[model samples]
Target: MDTLRYELVFSEGTDSGSSAGDVVTVERTSATGPGGHPVYTDPTGIIRAEISDQGEVRVLATGGHQDPAQGVRARPLPDAEERS
Candidate 1:
């Protein structure tokens, strides 16, 4: 129900990969599990931002059926960091 999307803004980068402020979208999907199931769980065990890459500034912990890359977690770093 809640469409969450980060307002991406490309600052600077080469012509190789994603630039700064790419406006990536965070998708939420129907997850069939004890966490989501109200009867099975209190709906609290759902994992959120815990650990991540060392250099990543703001990582997108995206997943669920809404995304094409389901199950594949991606933490797209800044444009400058990608170069390195």
Candidate 2:
């Protein structure tokens, strides 16, 4: 088993002001394969988030590769005026 480190950066958004940075740590584990074989892997993943100037929150992460399958997409956090 091993530990993985990841860094996340948040740039200024259309509404949100800005953010410093985020650090993440992940632990690996082993599992059984389709054929009942042992497989040791640490699947890649992606973290998605939305931030608003008013501090509204709507965020989530997908446990998988950071590739196309991750569907890494995000839109500006809606402003109070747009929430109506």
Candidate 3:
């Protein structure tokens, strides 16, 4: 399978002192999500994403949110990691 590459958009509060709309590169972890989708995490570990094979991105907030499941939605930036 081709490596899944993507970036995460971090908003204020999710990342302390960082400005809103900050983008960060994400690396796939050993974890899996629903239907065994690939789970990715940023360097800060503040954000987690499960991206479907069909390109659907599900944001999982590790912290900084009242409801962890109600993480800020984000679109997968295909190949965004290459630019990092």
For residues 1-84, write the lDDT of model 1, one tens digit per residue: 222212223334455554543333222224332333211111232222211222112322335653212222234333433458
Candidate 2 to native Cα RMSD, angstroms: 15.8
How does model 3 score by TM-score?
0.56
Report the alpha-carbon TM-score of model 1 versus the true structure: 0.18
Candidate 1's error at 77, in angstroms? 21
Q: In candidate 3, how many Å is residue 66 off?
A: 4.0
RMSD of each: 13.6, 15.8, 6.3
Which has the greatest TM-score? 3
Q: Native-vs-model 2 lDDT?
A: 0.31
Which model is ahead, 2 or 3, in terms of lDDT? 3
Any runs in candidate 1 off by more than 4 Å, and if so which? 1-3, 13-21, 29-57, 60-84
Task: Write one digit per residue (lDDT tens) for candidate 3, span 2-83.
Answer: 4555666546556465556667677788899876888888877876788776666777657664454433444555565666
lDDT of each: 0.29, 0.31, 0.66
lDDT accuracy of residue 64 in candidate 3: 62
User: For every model shown, what is its TM-score relative to the native structure?
Assistant: 0.18, 0.20, 0.56
